[model samples]
Target: MRLRHITGSEDFVADSPYVVHRSERYRGVWNRELFPKPQPIHLEIGMGKGQFITQLAVLHPERNYVGIERYDTVLMKALRKRESAEAAGCRLENLRYLSLDARLLPEHFAENEVSKLYLNFSDPWPKARQANRRLTSQVFLDCYTKFLRKDGTLEFKTDNTGLFDYSLESIPAAGWTLLAVSRDLHRDPVLNEGNVMTEYEEKFSARGNPICKLIAAPPK
Candidate 1:
């Protein structure tokens, strides 16, 4: 999908307190410096429009949430959504955004800094040659393990069957333990509980698409 560039989006993010403009500088101190108090940090990669992360942060005030998005336009939209929520009297003190590439996660976070990671409807780099680019690929999983604490969980949800199958194979291959797997997330009585819907999840599920989900933890 070609994203339309929005004018002043970068400037907007720079001025917004909700965005961590100089994320690299905060590296190991994010939890202590950003949130009101030190708490378990949960990160969501590719947090489009901020629905899931923002809502999750609101629901779980004890945990801090950081959303990472690469595109300026999309990140801007998420910022706007957050502003709208604030306008409606929502206190989003535990939430923040980072405009950065996922590959640089290790540079911006210290080892064991993140307690949980969320991947929702990520792009399916379907072609075999592009498998390395998949978020659940072995390469990315190794990177995730660096910052994710021991026993920390990575939860993934997607509507793409091919990506789901690939993740099921890639996760364990990277030596992570698959704690739970759901081919149809919404229908899974246990996994579906407390599931926050992203914009994509709501749209696709409304069209009768079965959402695939999984939870994996680093090997002890």
Candidate 2:
């Protein structure tokens, strides 16, 4: 997706206390350094506008949440949503935002540090030659193995059928196991329960687009 430069976004991200700067310094001790209490760490890659993660942070205060967005222009929007959530009387101290590339996750995190990882509607990189760029591809799955615990899991949601299908094949080929899968998540009452919708998810669902979800366990 082409991003239009948003004026002051870079400044806003730099100045926000919710944004974690020099995050590499806190690698192995993210839970110790970021939150008042040490707890399980849940990370969201490509956390677009922050709606999904902010809600997750509020709903599960026991967990430490980190959201990563590559662009300051995009992260600024998430910061505003986080602020709005706080204004509406939501507690989100356990949540923090990072303006970083997804491919660099291991550089900022230690081995077996993440408890759960979420990938939501990531760019599909549709071209066949660009398959390695998909979050579920072998390259990224290898990257994930470095930081995810033996029992840690990855949850992914997307409206793109091709991407979802690719993930279905890629994850298992990478030696991971699927715990759950739903081709139409909203139609599955069991899965839909406690599901938080991202802005794009809501828009797509409203248009009758099916949302696919999968829970994958890392190889031990």
Candidate 3:
């Protein structure tokens, strides 16, 4: 599902008045007109090219999705895809993007605001000193606890074995209970189905690397 040239000419004003501002950062917010009723909010950090969340938003229209990507170059692709989805009138009223750092999550969302968090093929800072920067680190997980609901879930996938192993050990320390873990996602078709492959995932899986996935929940 790769395109030779994604629409990149249209620039989005991050500070547009319509955008929601919190603690100096901007992100799109869904109004009551879009949902009619309050819906559960789900977030995906580092949503590369928006393939995963875009499909998820279309499939689960009952829930709202927010994708956070720091890089505008890559973020534009996701926006284009979302715009196309919206133009078709295909149930894309629930999706939005945030160009901000993952560390700034607390400022934008209130306590118990997010129901689920997705981390897919995040950067694996393989060095020891850089471990804190990993998205699955205890520090970041602790930050998420501030916004995640009591029964909130964190779904993660990565092709890096080191990161996967590190997460398996860090989740408990961060006060999250590991619910499901898989070293080879392809073996389980049910969960794999409708799972949109990211740019990195498509490349690594093509090389025969088994993708690792896990589901963790905040301890009640």
Candidate 4:
């Protein structure tokens, strides 16, 4: 998918307090002082257009929410959404964005720092050779384990069956225990309740696509 490059997106991000300019500088200090109340940090990796993470931040003001995106153009959209929300009198003090690659997670987060991780409709990287690039691949799972707390849960939702299957296998292979699995997320009334929808999730599910979801935790 071609991203519409927003002119001055980089400049906007640099000026916004919501975007962490030098994320690595904070590192282990994020929880101590970055957010107002030192709440448990919940991260949404590959946050597209900011829908899910932003809504989560609004719904749960007690928790700190961070949305990480690699593309400046995409991150800009997410940042703008926060601005719009604030303009409409929404309090988003606990929300923030990081324009960085997922691979650098360890450099910016301390061990057991993140309380929960969300992977929403990440790139499938379907080709056999590109399998490792999938967010659910062992490469990324290993990276997540380093930052997630002992009982930290990683919740994932995707429309791609191949990627979902791969994640089911990869999680256990990486020594994480699968806590829950749902092939059809919306069908499960228990999981569907209070489930925030991502941009892709709403688009796909409207077309009758069965969304896949799972929750897994690092082994103790």
Q: What is the TM-score of each candidate against the true structure?
A: 0.98, 0.98, 0.85, 0.97
Model 2, C-alpha of 54: deviation from truth (Å): 0.5
Which stretches of candidate 4 lie above 4 Å from their native place? none
Against the unseen true structure, what C-alpha lDDT does each candidate score?
0.93, 0.94, 0.80, 0.91
Per-residue lDDT of model 1, residues 150-214, tens digit only = 97999999999999999999999999999999999999999999889999999999999999999
- Candidate 2 per-residue lDDT, tens place, 85-150, comes to 989999898999899887898999999999999999999999999999899999999999999999
Candidate 1, residue 110: the lDDT equals 93
lDDT of 4 by residue, 159-181 (tens): 99999999999899989999999
Candidate topping lDDT: 2
Better of 1 and 4 by TM-score: 1
TM-score of candidate 4 against the unseen true structure: 0.97
Q: Give the TM-score of candidate 3.
A: 0.85
- 5: Cα error in model 3, Å: 15
Collision count for each candidate, in order:
0, 0, 0, 0
Candidate 1 error regions (>4 Å): none
Error of 2 at 128 (Å): 0.7
**Better by lDDT, candidate 3 or 2:** 2
Instruction: List, residue by residue over 1-220, the lDDT tens digit for candidate 3.
Output: 3435434422552533222334333222343433445799899999978888988888898898888887766777777777777798777767767777999888777778789999999989899999999999998998889888989899999999999999999999887899899899877786687677777888889999999999999867
